[model samples]
Target chain A: MEQPEEVPHNPTEQAAICFKAFMLKNSPKSNLNLYDHLVRVLCKVMDERPENAVDVIEDLSLEVKRTGMRDKQSTLRDTPPVPAVQLLAEQQKTLFTRGSGDDVEPEEELVETPLPNLAEQSFYLEQAGVGLPREELQRIHLALKQLVDAQPLQTCRFWGKILGTQANYLVAEVDFREGEEEDEEGLQEDGADEEEKEGGAGDEDEEEATEEIDPLPVSAYKPPPAVPKEENHTGVNKFTYFVCREPGLPWVRLPPVTPAQITAARQIRRFFTGNLDAPIISYPPFPGNETNYLRALVARISAGTQVSPLGFYQFGEEEGEEEEEAARDSFEENPEFEGVPVPEMVDSMANWVHHVQHILQQGRCVWVNLAEKPEEDLEEEGDEEEGEEEPDEPEPEVGPPLLTPLSEDADIEGTPPWSCKMSSTLIPQFAIAVLRSNLWPGAYAYATGNRKFENIYIGWGMKFVGEGYTPPMPPAPQREYPSGEEITEALDPSLEEEQALQAALEERRAAEEEAEELEGEEEEEEEDDY
Target chain B: MGVTEDELKDKKALYSLNCIDWHLLPLPTPVLLAEVAAVAKGRFVGDPSFEYELTETRQQGEGDEAVKEEFTMKVTEEKRLAATVFNIEKDVSVVPRGAFIRTPHDTVQVNHSFQGLSTLEARNLGNYLHFTEPQQLKKKSILEMADLDPSIDFLDPLSEDILKGSWSLQMEGSSMCVLRSLLWLGLTFFHVPATPQHGYIYMGDGLKNLDLPFML
Candidate 1:
């Protein structure tokens, strides 16, 4: 609202101009930059029209002051957050502490897990022309004994070697003592405490500053279809694993595997270098270190290849009908299983069946979360795009049932994954029957005429893909520009369309001439007035 | 009586008995008997039985015209065990390079000067040959046999077994060399590092592993 004859002057704008001039003339050269910054900040405040402009400017000023003084005050503040190396070291300390139990009974050891006679087993293995060298076998046996005594384990079995570039990992699979769930809970609490300490150290002051204004509650990003605890004596998560570079070295227990990790591991093919902490720099990068990957792989190999003679084991009794109805179905050794003849076993692939439950596409032997979560939650989290499951949906495909014959499972290439053989052709009755997995090379199982069988794997864990193992190649780089159909001028245009284009062009030119003529006349009139 | 000197002289002829020295070259029959006795002692609870028979019953022609013929082959437990040992040895028994050689008279004899295989040669299954006769040399073309040593190559190499990777050669205790056969489960061949000390034994049941080809 300016009056016709009055000169408009905003006091604040005038004042800002005056202040800038005064500062330039009066302030020392050293402080000139700071003064100019102050002027700019004020100018920003006046130029922007925000609802809470005063409060916003006040925040901006305080932020500027804090940044200006940051260098001087940095030394006064507490040391920065704990580095990744220290955190890793702390984690490793906890792992070792957890594995090494102080008290293990000596007299009651015999009644503990019945350890396989390594020397006797080696003798048979050598006869069949499989297994590690005698010296290696002896070392492994002794080391495993030492491990059993050191850890509070119910049972321990040597789970063969996984060949690595630098060194091989001698894995020992062990089950926890009965009712050891309390110790696991304690371990989890310790982990939680450590996490709280880390969180408190890094952002305690910031949290205090905004205490009155509650922070937004952020829901953690949980990987879908979380792996359930293995409460039974079967499946991938039933046992823990400890691995070492050499037999005599200290055993490092690998972290329990997650279904997500196993699923990711299935997509990658990498050689272990016997280092647990080594990074897996791969496409769709692995979630954890080699230790976790090794655990997942061990689980996979167990589910895929661990097998026994048919009728050797029967489905274990499902305990507790109510509440635990969806419990994992397990297998137990059949007391009445009489040994099959070696000739009969060697004659066909049907005699051999996987005793371990089959691993479903979801990387677990059993899908246990069926009755727990609502159908909607399951659908949202499940990897499959299973269309809106109804409340009464049929049981999802878990996989072929436990103890399915080896012959029933075909290799990806349509060839039988297993090859059955008798130990000796000269003496059919006395010879043992052997089954070797062609799908996963280096996995072999042998059974004697009587009730005795064992499965062992010794290879650079890789699936046989017909040819030599090759790391999958990265996808080809995307083309920068999309290709389009080539346009040629050979085709003639219709007469009507051509005439329309010509008329539109002529009309546009005439309009341009008219505007130009009007502008030239206005210029002439202005010149006459001058 | 008065007789011609030439005729009378021949009448004083003498005969001398000649026997094979069992110490130098042990009689195979007795050794075979000992093996059977050991096996029979275990099977029959210290009663070395002399009777074990394998009966073969064949029915000829269709159901209506079928003539049931029963053939009873009378065999002792000893003979059966000996036959089994012979069968296993025929297929899987192996010897290191130069351990045996072909004589000019077309016979294979132990090479006394073989000083055992070198460590490098010991590692490879190709350096060991089946103790039995060489079927491969006879089948090889003249061009393929050009580089083969007739004296040493008179037997097929263990590497030439029908199923490749059936033979596993390894060093035990870094001193004693051992070769095991996957096909013949209990067949084990041991050789001292560097001496004319090598031997093979098949202690498995009397059966041939026909499934080896599939395993490989």
Candidate 2:
């Protein structure tokens, strides 16, 4: 990893330097050029910290250098190491002494949180962006041609957009309000011209020229009407574009007055505090993402603290089964002979693991809704003035409001008053991408993407998806993996041999202690004789 | 994959990234937690595209003021990953002019021209690139999946350190297509056969045509 004396002033230059180094080191004489990589690194950086472009780019290069180019090639999923990171068995208290308990982290372990992936950086960029130099803009546009190369994923915007609120937001399009200035200038100007002409011009000539009554005054090109100044202080801005091959980069992010999002974020925090017992909905591809998101809001009430009477245990399976024993028992079960189909066994096992993830510790797997448009967008279109500029024109086409979708998604109709909602597409829209980028890395670790010290043994299981009362799986069975000895026994012989050798080496240290003791005793005798 | 780590490591963990085989995914383990991450697979037709549909369904749940207040069946969801295949035009030049599309993951392509089909000719509307195409994934068998099979020794079952895989695929063969379909256009590592023995695959327009006949 190259260390920067200080972060370079020009991000593109630094990106160019790293990009060249990266290409030479990674793909010399290959098709991917320095410009291509520089753009991705730069755009991703600028999006996350628009104002801090220099810092972002420097941090990015630093990240690239420090982590090595090899690391970026893979997914951001953090593992609890090969032993499929199990939640560390916790004790009442931890010791500070060297190597005392499960709490003692190994010196070599890289317990690092992943920097946002290209996808996440792009997603955040979608909601927000930083202004860029025009030269960089040209570079991005030219790179757009190159961005179309074959890719697994590519960045794009969500269709149903929310216009804006108090926070900073990207100007997606011109927002058309209901009322117009009503051609007051044209009417007033024409009247003044008529009065002046009535005195000077003859009636016959005036009548002949009437055919050309209101030739629009060739006044200087008037910039389009201004948006209500009270809404946002920042003037109209241009969006940042990057070369795209496939997905991973977010186009931009919107900052709206999403109190529910904030409330949900708070609820998420409280869920960790053991304040909410809202059952975690499964990850994506399951059904009912609404439930997952709505429950996110109800972790507690803001007015006063009222923890849900129901905790994680309510959603769990029958009690009395130990996690380790259950895991072992399930692991040992040859489901093929046990009368279950492989797929069924797989589902059952997945469910069991899912249950173990949810019950034994805090559940991290969250349901995030991917995109689908909402009604307000259509309504807002109707509300747009007919006199407004053409729809197809890129000139200032702002989007609709934010709150409706959240309230729509979160609405409660049939349920008793105790229930919250999972109605809005917004819940899934903003949250899903962020969740995937954030928690995906730790999904497999035993702590399921949590820290050992936090004792928050949890990680995302599966995101809830689909559109039905998909019959909930028979509650998850208790789960465990083979014990340390058993898990290790299945490992390489060299590892065991290494273990034995280390044990032997530790025991051998006693000889040195014994030798020193004998020498001291002999010395004492010699002194007595003297 | 050749696209290295986004999550920068502290100087301490740099060694893990430096080592070619050490990776953070699949949570490397000795005893195969074969069940944790299994390979799943499916097939695509001759063309490089799929049909997209947005379907809606209603789910009724009893809860507080919010639960019953919202949702008329779930609004606008995908019933399947892909409902139809959007064929790209055969002409290489038309690719950037055709349509915008994406994979199940957020991987997106603008003005994507797949090998052409007449059914979609009339519908080549350039206006709609915003809604990223949702993906279609089947309950693919572990054997059918891409990276999982290459590195894993299911037959012997975790005899060695769990074999890790980067996005390594052969460039000159049809394996690229099959692999490309699976991986979309993420960064990948390829094993170069020469003395030094390392190569990489990234999404690039320059190398669009390579070994074609060998793909599955």
Candidate 3:
């Protein structure tokens, strides 16, 4: 909320200053004094008529300043000498004067006070500057409107990328064509069947011919069993492509395309053909690696020739000129066909075709034949191997010459030095080192005496090393001490100490035992006494 | 958490550079609706108008015992806030002929490093700074002055104000974390404010950290 610096400026700068002033006025801390300062500054700086600016600034300044001061006074903690009843009465009076309709009254009660009259204040300010005229404001407004309109398309492009719809245009076009066909078929077969029947023998012949032209045999054309549509379902447009079987067979029971889908398609198409310089296609993952369909599409498109009914077409005569121009330009510029030498365009088309074919082949939906190498090739190689095996018997004759020269040199040199060693001895070591370096750099570096390399390599290697060789161990269990009975036993005196303290009691117990032994004899006497 | 007017003002001052002119563009109803719904669903939660104060800190000493010196800036929302620090050393020693050297030679090895640092310290500091409650006043304020009728709600539950606010807060928080990491690096290493002699080193380091989202 720093105050914008004031300087002599142009119209754009003046407009900016005005905007800043407006923003400042809306800020929570703004007061009439600040508003007045802003208006005066704007009036001084703008090229607009000085009288109108001054009047607006002055009126706004006074009104705002008065309101702000009054607000401040009421907010002070010090209570007025007047009773609460009087205050309430005054409040009611203000409320009554302020249009106390059912809604307005309730709102006023909720707010507890009048809200700032922003519209009223702004209106008065504008009224005061009426001399400045409305044309200028209109121009500014129009400029702002234009700026606003351009943003969404840009945003759509940005978000489209984020949403991973890179081939939006191509997908949309395909969807559109599919939708139109479904709709036309739906109309023809459903309600239009009666009309066709009424049209007589010619229509019937056409229908029969259409049925015959369908590639699938009548037995294979058994429609998929229909599922009941759920209640409250948002239906799709039947005219659009809903779903198709493998090898590009259109669905028979087409659903209507939703408005949302149509919009999405349109947006995507606009994005591709409008902004993008190249033809974009979406090769969704195919089933079972059947890439032929995708490859065919790519090849057809790459030729700069339409795949007849499947390719893009101008919608009407009005668009025909544009479409023809675009097609001609594309044909001339795209080197995928016999055209201009646009290497980039050619490369892109080739890449697209390759990628499409690859995706279709590897896709989950498409089925592909592996076509493993012919068995005859393997047999021929095997025969060559057998012929080479027969030559091995003369290997000793070849080996003796190869070894004798080396042995003679070794004899003269008192055995070959380590560096001069060849074949088996050096090969194993070198292979092991190479393999070790690739697999476990740490172990390799450790053996090679490279410290820095060992540090990084060893750090990574230990993570994968087998079982017991692993360094870090899992956490150990915690032990808890016994309580209750254990604590009581620890606190209690020994039995021996107790017995020492109670010798007389032990003697009494012995005397009682002796008495008990005599009790059998005494019992006869006690029975007589009883 | 509900924000006080003062807090709101402070936030506007603190992270203004992150602000985008979304208001300048008119969006389709569906897009706007989606944005609003996201805010209402708590997918968006941030203060869009907040500005961040940029600060640069350099370690003052050599090796392990380096202390730090700091320079702070209160930048406006429009300007990009960035800092660069460099490490430079001059080598004037001459090499003598030896078995390893092979021949007499004079070599000077100068090492210079540069790093571009972002200024988001204010956001981190925001987490620590607590505001004192203002004393209740009887005076009418702008909040009281701008009261609207209860029957009328100018904005829907998923309005631009709420959505933009939420997004700004989330993005700002992430940016703050990134800035903290950069500051940590500065504090760890003994670096000097970027100069022509050490520009290369700073540039290289800066490039290494450029993938960091909030870096200028």
TM-score of predicted chain A against the true chain A, for each candidate: 0.59, 0.13, 0.12
**Comparing candidate 1 with candidate 3, which one achieves the higher TM-score?**
1
Candidate 2: misplaced stretches above 4 Å?
Answer: A1-530, B1-187, B191-195, B199-216
Q: By DockQ thresholds, what CAPRI class is model 1?
A: incorrect
Q: Point out the worst 10-residue segment of candidate 1 chain B by lDDT.
A: B7-16
Q: How does the DockQ of candidate 2 come out?
A: 0.01
Report the C-alpha lDDT of model 3 over A492-515, residue by residue, as the tens digit. Answer: 769897877578655755676677
RMSD per model, one decimal = 33.9, 44.8, 44.1
Tens-digit per-residue lDDT, B45-105, candidate 3: 1243334344668788898899888865442212211111111111011111110111112
Provide the lDDT at A229 for model 3. Answer: 22
| CAPRI quality level assigned to candidate 3 from its DockQ score | incorrect
Give candidate 3 regions above 4 Å deviation. A1-482, A486-489, A492-505, A517-530, B1-84, B87-216
In CAPRI terms, model 2 is classed as incorrect
Candidate 2's TM-score: 0.15
Q: What is the per-candidate TM-score for chain B?
A: 0.69, 0.18, 0.15
